[model samples]
Target: MSDRDASTPRVILARHGETEWTINGRYTGITELELTPRGEQQVLSTGKLLVGTGKLIDPVQLERVFVSPRRRARKTFELLFGTESELAALNKVEFTEDIAEWGYGAYEGLFGEEIVARRNEQGLDTERPWDIWKDGCEGGESSEQATQRLDSLINRIRDIQRPYMHGEKPVDIVLVAHGHILRAFAKRWLGVPMGSPLAMMLPPGAIGVLSYEEHDINAPAFLVGIALPLEEK
Candidate 1:
């Protein structure tokens, strides 16, 4: 791990490529849908832009990768890295249920408006439109549950990073999953409340970067953008 530079460790949150459900505004939880034809192209282009030896996410510096087990997520991981056999060589990739898409249960595959209508008919969220962050999904994973699992992942990442952050060996972690969970993960990373109104977006195949502020473990923050660390040939 001696290849690290003076900068702090980084965590890359990558949402999977477009899907039928995503384009149609469906809840898309636990349905195991495939990415659309354009989804594959989207991820390929992203890999070209953001992943490489000197790119934003240099794979050699990656300490660990956490991917959701859903097909769309797996496909994105595969597109970003390689096939299953190729990924085995990296020894840092883990496809886990902990990062799976938020389970919508009865609300799975329903559009937002449709979910709101049904919830209203059921005498739920009657006063206000259904907000997944606030009301959560009926018979599905709750905001608290999302907080618990995401916090566990964040702690695990911190454990891996805390001891080595200042060392010469830099470290990075990658999280590939669906829209809602990744957004929730970002909130949890900063110790934010899961039920807080989230006004962020990570469109398909988009990547968001996160890092500790001022090399302090307690001060996590979003790295929205920065000038490229370019070097002359």
Candidate 2:
């Protein structure tokens, strides 16, 4: 998502690979789970494609890595950078709960259909049903709570990149975490409201990049389908 000598800093968001819960569409938050075997291979492939001396994620440009504390997310980091690879030796990696999946609480293992049924059984309002963006999980985090934590993290990232905005600094960073929280993070990155409906998606094991427009920190925007051009012979 960036050049090794990029003047503009960018944030890379990487979702962990598939787990059993991911396949079953279960609300997996806080509860730790390992990546499926296929998931492992998927991450390995992604690493080869994106991380290298001249790739989208040039290791030399990585200022820091914010990863979920969950095992699955950590495993992805290991695979992406390769446990013994020099790139993996970068010293600023942080395993934090702030980027962890949205805490599912009572809906931790429940599917969407099941959550609605449970809410109905408990005599809760079903007219609007169980829209996580709106209703949120009963015992888990409210949209407000998610916003607070993500906003804090976003501020930190911006602080790191702000001074280096027009300078030649390797200020790019990566976030390794679950799907829901990363998506929420993206929303907050663009100053979008939490309750706003999100059609953007970062599927399991997918990579996304966000950055400022025209090197202006005041105009943060999501970077999509970015491709570096071929050099002339």
Candidate 3:
């Protein structure tokens, strides 16, 4: 069922490491936060794993790289691939808010346990059967807004792919971003309905590969694999 030929491009998604909020299950949005010590190790392990995978972008063949504007994501890109001169000499990396994490609004610092308790006390289990992308953020983004943002970002990637089929150079694109947004991107890539919350669930410091096979322009994107190399012992 391979639709991609040799012409279609591949996308590698890198999820940023654990911030304090992530470790505590807080709904982190665009708010900038540094990775915790554990988070830093997780990211380092990812970089080490990537190097071992032999997926290093060959300076000659490497095309473009993109990172979410959030500090955690941006730092992951810089650390994993090396800073400005390092990546630029090997490949081009750009920062774009389009790939930022889901905007959580009022839920920014609350974990699942906290959310559940708060809802319970209010006599309304607002988060029951909770699906992040399908829930309202109160002072933040609605599920609709999250879906729309993912859709727009995916569309941007698609536009880049169009020209790639007609002899334009094939670009190996890498995106450094958050777990929730990347999961949504995976859904959109495969044409899955936006509400399918389980399309993909990535852990902090995970690496996911999305590639086309057999050059089928209409073929759905595939999730080659998602690896979290630095989980706790």
Error of 3 at 70 (Å): 1.2
The number of the candidate with the highest TM-score is: 1
Higher lDDT: candidate 1 or 2?
A: 2
Residues 1-233 of candidate 2 have per-residue lDDT tens digits of 44333467899999999999999898899888999998988898898888877788877888999999999999999988877746446567888889999988899888888888888899888476567876777888998999999999999999999988875688899999999999999999999988898688887889999988777878898876677533345
Give the whole-model CA lDDT for all candidates, comma-separated.
0.84, 0.86, 0.71
Alpha-carbon error at 164 in model 2, in Å? Answer: 1.0
TM-score of 2: 0.92
lDDT of 3 by residue, 1-233 (tens): 63445445767788998888887676888778999888888988878666432344333334677889888987887768666546666447678877887777766788777776765676765546555566666677776776777778777777777567543685667888998888887887787776765545789988887766555446656756433334445
Candidate 1 C-alpha lDDT tens digits along 64-90:
999999999999998998775344586
Candidate 3 C-alpha error for residue 65, in Å: 1.9
lDDT of 3 at 222: 70
How would the candidate models be sorted by lDDT, starting from the highest? 2, 1, 3
